[model samples]
Target: MQTIRSINLQKNLGDVLRTADVETVLVTNRDQPRAVVMSAEEFIRLKTAAGEPVPNEVRKSSPTLHRRIADPLGYDTRDPGYVEQTASDALDGQHADEIAREIDKAMRRWRLR
Candidate 1:
């Protein structure tokens, strides 16, 4: 990626467009990035990967997902005496045989295959 000031972008539009075809070019205004220039193929690929849901809509619909997105580390380490726990209780030193028995019981209870 390359950063170009707004004035420089205007002066070197042709070269910037050519560069953007190969990689991303960030356009900056007043030293802050204002826009991105990339190939149409790259733009489409990124949009497809991102999916259709807007961030605010997703945040409003699911609080748990919103928290996960806001804190990718699962929990805030900045909290006093914060203890990071594993994602699942089943992984807490359970033997394979015990886990298999629990899974079998759950499957039978739930009528799941």
Candidate 2:
């Protein structure tokens, strides 16, 4: 809840930012808030704790690719196109079993299994 005029931000940005415990510095223009300056680490920690999705660049650079996808557009989860099946689905029906057997035979022939 720190506020400073735009001119002050330009003059003593570092000092103003250092005064806050949460590192959120509000910049104001003409007595109205215009922008915020905060530490990137703090911002990321807060966003993660709030269950917000990290940016794609952050995800791509991360060591793990297991982050949950956050869709704000309200996608239709019931759509068949959105559903993904596990390998166990290969054993679910006669047609799937036949396909799995063919795949297994091909893998054995190629020494892949």
Candidate 3:
């Protein structure tokens, strides 16, 4: 996924929409993801896979108007609930493979892996 700042999205709506046609674009506000813009076909496939009924208007609208943002941790980085830690914490008492696993874990946790 590629990230685009909210201001940039506003300034280049057409370009952003075009990019969304190829891949998911994460729209960010203050460096935190706020929404996702994907191709209409992908959205419908996702909804169908999830067993959610696709309304006529939604099918017509496709990817626009329907907004979905997922944050499994329940908050963004700007929130006080988010904790920032150093890599040293993971390195302590851990072997090389363990350290690699920890790195992989963090990336997967952020859905970036």
Candidate 4:
């Protein structure tokens, strides 16, 4: 973001508008930020985003909406929570732990042979 004092903004309105299209611009009055200038695309994007409600978990995890911003992993939208719920229900947490221990014991016994 670039900071432009109110005096500079008025004096260089064309230059300031050009800069704002490339990136966000902060307008300040007496060294205090008073307003922001962003491109039309950015303004529309922010307006659309403001209309939607985000999940609490997602909000807490990423205040800047950084979730899935980098190296995003694709998910199958065709199958919703039901598929995941069914798969998770297939194995209880306790039973999975017990099975893991049993496998470790068997692997150790085999290694001793």
TM-score of each: 0.44, 0.41, 0.51, 0.44
Which portions of model 2 show Cα errors greater than 4 Å? Answer: 56-113
Estimate, for each residue in 14-75, the C-alpha lDDT of model 1 and write its tens digit: 99999987999999999998999987556655755789533442223221244345433334
RMSD of each: 14.5, 13.8, 16.6, 13.9
User: Highest lDDT, which number?
Assistant: 3
lDDT of 4 by residue, 1-113 (tens): 99999988888888889998789999999999999988655665565579954344322322122344421222232223334754564454534555566578778979952
| Model 1 pairs whose backbones collide | none
lDDT for 109 (candidate 2):
87
- The local distance difference test score of each candidate is 0.64, 0.59, 0.66, 0.63
Clashing pairs in 3: none
Top model number, TM-score: 3
For model 4, which pairs clash? none
Which is the better candidate, 2 or 4, if ranked by lDDT? 4
The residue-by-residue lDDT of candidate 3 on 28-113, one tens digit each, is 99988899999766776688789997666545422212137343323333222233332343345434565576579789989998
Q: Candidate 1: where are CA atoms >4 Å away? A: 53-113
